[model samples]
Target chain A: MSGGVLYRPGDSPVHRIPPQVKLLAAFAAVLGVVATPREAFWAFGIDLFVVLAVWSVAGVPVGWFARRAVIEAPFVLLAVVLPFVSGGPRVDVLGVAVSQDGLLAGWNILAKGTLGVLIALTLAATTQPRDLVLGLQRLRAPAWFVTIATLMLRYVDVIAGELRRTRIARISRGDDPRFLWQAGAVARGAGTLFLRSYERGERVHRAMLARGWAGHMPAGPAAPVGALRWVAGGSPALVIATAWAVAAWPV
Target chain B: MTASVAMHLSDGVLDASTSVLFGAVAVAWLAVAAARGRIDVDDRTAPLAGLLAAFLFAMQLLNFPVLPGVSGHLYGGALAAILLGPWVGALCLSVVVVIQALLFADGGLTALGANMTNMALLGTAVGFAVALAARGLARRSRAGLLAVAFLAGLVSTVAASAGFVVEYAIGGQADVSLGGLAGVVIGVHAVIGIGEGVITALAVGAIVRVRPDLIYLVRTSETRELVAA
Candidate 1:
């Protein structure tokens, strides 16, 4: 449940940019990348460069993106398999037979998926978790949805700690959780965790009630976003748009 | 399991049009789930749903061995539905999907709708309906309840994978054969579904023994069965 913020503390201008703007920019960049057809290879290249430029400006290391990009590992595997199994005209690559369409398809997934992951990582790295929540709230996501997501993020660490403690106790008692034979214990442990979490929720509700809380989550006044902040946060997305425009321009 | 449990697709997996279309579907689903959560008879449903969302995220970290080298964790769609009825369960799962994409780079931000529609909507609701039907067929025994959980997990995984196929059929960017993709995806998930079934049944069985009341699926019916016994 590594739900902790990937935000790196920095004095860079990227950090100072409003999270809502950053969020919008991230979404727009991803859409820009996704919208560019696979044939529009130049737009994809520009998208990557824009993301990297922002990355360098933000001062986040390449290692961070590389490590987190492993989340895309399974998809990369899917991409690799596409060429061999895909039904299309076969093309030879270094003496190996491959589907021509599959190669392009694989490349499409690789390029766009990679850029999407990078842009997401950049936003996660530069934005605080609290600000992310605030951004969601300010963006007028359903109040209950925001509240639940915020609360879940808040308690993920706590529940994860509980999991760690439980696992430690189990290991000390000679339980190997990784093996299938011990799945019964794992399931039971999960059940126990669920029970404990549910009860904790009850206690949390009582505490909230005691503090004069209502059913509704109160959102504080949001700070205004200026034109300058939008421009600052939107620079990379602007790059993506320009690249898209160039590709779309009548030749 | 990674394909199924970590169900969110990275960006560009589906074309932008398909992503936006599914995103609209996801938003509408969330609004319905949110509205239902707010107006539910139980006042504590919201907080409970919130904590359950956290619980599912935590449970995901604990993976069980599924094969010679494969392992799978709880996808929690069926588990959530059984514990907290469909609407709240869907909302809870949606929250997890949303957060996983946002904070963690686990899913694509642009693909959020496709991910959400598939996992939160399809993965959850179908499992719940099946489990409810299974419960009726199996009647009021401990074995029956476990069977419901098993069926729920199986149906949920298969259904969710099928959903991926549907989305892929609509806007799959890959030039791969849609039929081939569907077969491979569903085949993998069927095996994954067995492991899901076992874990889900056992997990639900454990809770049924301790606190049957907490599981929304069997709460009243199970209570009635216990009294008869």
Candidate 2:
């Protein structure tokens, strides 16, 4: 189990924007992409441009973004299946009739899904995990939710390291996870790992209480978001909304 | 097997109305879970819940081979519910889902609500209930416990798939008919469900053998029976 995060450390302007604002901006951009008509291909182009502009500003490599965006491969597989199975007026392509509506639907899924993913990737690349939790806290999310999220971010890597060790130990003992017959042993290893994690949690809780931990996680220093940060953080969403409004306007 | 559950519904897959409806339902479920004190954690339970979220995240990364050229990973809803109880299980899974979407880009941001509802809310609730019912029917023998755990995993995956079908029926963007889509989705998921069941059973069985005290559902039920006696 790798760290399972995509955050890249940088001091670019995009990285300086507060995590909450970037979160909101990402949300707004996704809404814009989803709301745009599929026929408005130019709107999708504008959305991509916005994403690229952020990528460039953040100094994130396009190859890096592309590599991470492969997580959307499953959705792409679903999109490829849509054109054949979907019912619509038929269009001839390479002597085969396919649903015209399905093609549009497939394109719709591919374009919008990719855009949503790109925006999210930008957010992840620019925001640190701790800052993200802090951002949630500042946004007035529930205290318990923030605390759990904070602890989760803090310990995810630790548990992932433990998992790797467990896998290695299993392999050294002749257990192979690749064979279906070995699934029982693999799952037992997972069970042992869970029990160990449970005990570690208990011990950590005790240590925290011994050092003086109240019911709530203590608040960190207040860092106010300036208007300039909002403007910079929100530009991608602004571009996307403008593109949608323009595309939707009657000639 | 290489196949895993559709972790998240992507944008444009469903109509706006359908997304909003499912999103609202997910939010309502979260509120209910919180109101029921399921998300609440004391000092002792808080660390456990957090570590459980991390553990789930790690486990999902480890996919086990099921069929040739296909693999499956633990959704872990049944395992979590058995160990932590349903409410905390739901919360922990929700946290993992959120982090996956945000950090790993494994799920769509807009479809977060639908994903959470299907995986976290429905999976944990249905899985836990099925486990309890199966346990009751099996008379709680050692083998019976393992069998129920397997059954719980199977039912949870099927239930989550059913949830997707319902959402697709309501707000599907593609032109495919409901029956046709449901048939394929449910059929493929049934196989995945078996993998889920096997892994969940093994995990539960191992824990039960070593430290029965850590199994929350078992502990609570035994205490209830003691009170009745």
Candidate 3:
């Protein structure tokens, strides 16, 4: 499902880095960004610069990341309204009175939200989905949890396709799922969809049993990554850490 | 249209300490839920949990218009909790939320723990609690069952919404008006909760008709009491 759409095929240094290292680095970078105090705008700037530079190095297009970043729109709305509703010391900007604290909070949300989404998109863009499963297993994630995630990644697209067909069938029957009156049909559709999906699961289990499938999928522990790759791959987190420390020690 | 997963908080909205604190809570409960689900039905848990997670992912994509220009989809917690026990339901929803956050970017990665806590753990627990409380009425008739499901959906949704507010109050960096924020958010969700209730009722009703045994709450109870079936 995610084979073509979310993940892009690339051979950059970022892509070559093991998925486990990249996942840890992305997570740590986000922690650093979030932990950096809201007053430290310059530190946030350096965090953004480091993220963008990596995206460039990984050959991820700015337009691609920007388009996918549309998911953050709702958070942006919340951030924008904060300045208006916030009660604090007033500051006049653009000929309107706005709360200075609210303005800082708004910037905080926007900057950190952008950085978090971009960092995740980079991992998704660089690593294949299957590789992510490997990363999880290597990270000592529970086998059952990884098993569920793997099956979900496998089946989500098929189910979405089924949903598309179901929607089309509704439309063909002169049912517009868009109207509130048609919600009954939509719910029933969801109900039957559940049965279909459940039966599909049952069948899959039966097939596995018939094939003498073991209770678990074969997932071997991956070879350990090297120290140099750890430091190099973790550079994003390192940069944000330095910025955070610089901001912190001054206080 | 908001994916059920969209109920999540965005990154950096909560301070790092709050995020980490909630993260620990999420991981702790998730581990317990996984362990419990595994002990119940050893072999089928994987396929059931996996496909159920997929089912939820697809269900969230089916958004029905709630307003003139607004649409909302099933969070699917009540329905899932009613079908599978809370253990399986929580695990399934957690998987969906993680995938949505990681692969789709529908939710924030950094706030993954917080999202899992509210959307998956709290919602499923609340849903099942309501279902258990109304067990007698639900067993009597289909109408009663639907009503119970509706109530489950409404209360669970409000509970999850309240969760976000609590976290925001504690960890929010900006000194925004908490009262106003809570009102707007809870008020909108109250209306959306009605939609959540109705949709949940209808869906559960359909499942009851086709596969009565699949309803976990109704099943493990006094089988002789299931007059609705």
Point out where model 1 deviates above 4 Å: A1-5, B3-6, B39-43, B67-69, B221-229
Among all windows of 10 consecutive residues in model 3 chain A, the one with the lowest summed lDDT is: A1-10
Which CAPRI tier for candidate 2? medium
Clashes of 3: 0
Candidate 1 local lDDT, B80-168, one digit each (tens): 88888788889988888887788788789988998888788887889889988877753579998888898898889888888888888
The predictions' CA RMSDs to the true structure, in order, are 3.0, 2.7, 2.8
Q: Give the winner by lDDT.
A: 3
- What residue runs in model 3 are displaced by over 4 Å at the alpha carbon? A3-5, B1-6, B39-41, B221-229
Model 1's CAPRI class is: medium
TM-score of chain B of 1: 0.90
The lDDT values for all models are 0.81, 0.80, 0.83
After superposition, candidate 2 runs with Cα above 4 Å error: A248-251, B1-5, B221-229
Query: What does candidate 1 score in Cα RMSD to the true structure?
Result: 3.0
Candidate 2: C-alpha RMSD after superposition: 2.7
Residue by residue across B54-103, what tens digits does model 3's lDDT show?
A: 88987886678886677888887787788888988999898888877777
Worst 10 residues of 2 chain A by lDDT: A175-184
Candidate 2 lDDT over residue span B34-102, tens digit each? 656534545555566787887887788787887567676788877887777788888888888887788
**DockQ of each candidate's interface versus the true one?**
0.62, 0.64, 0.62
Grade the docking of candidate 3.
Answer: medium
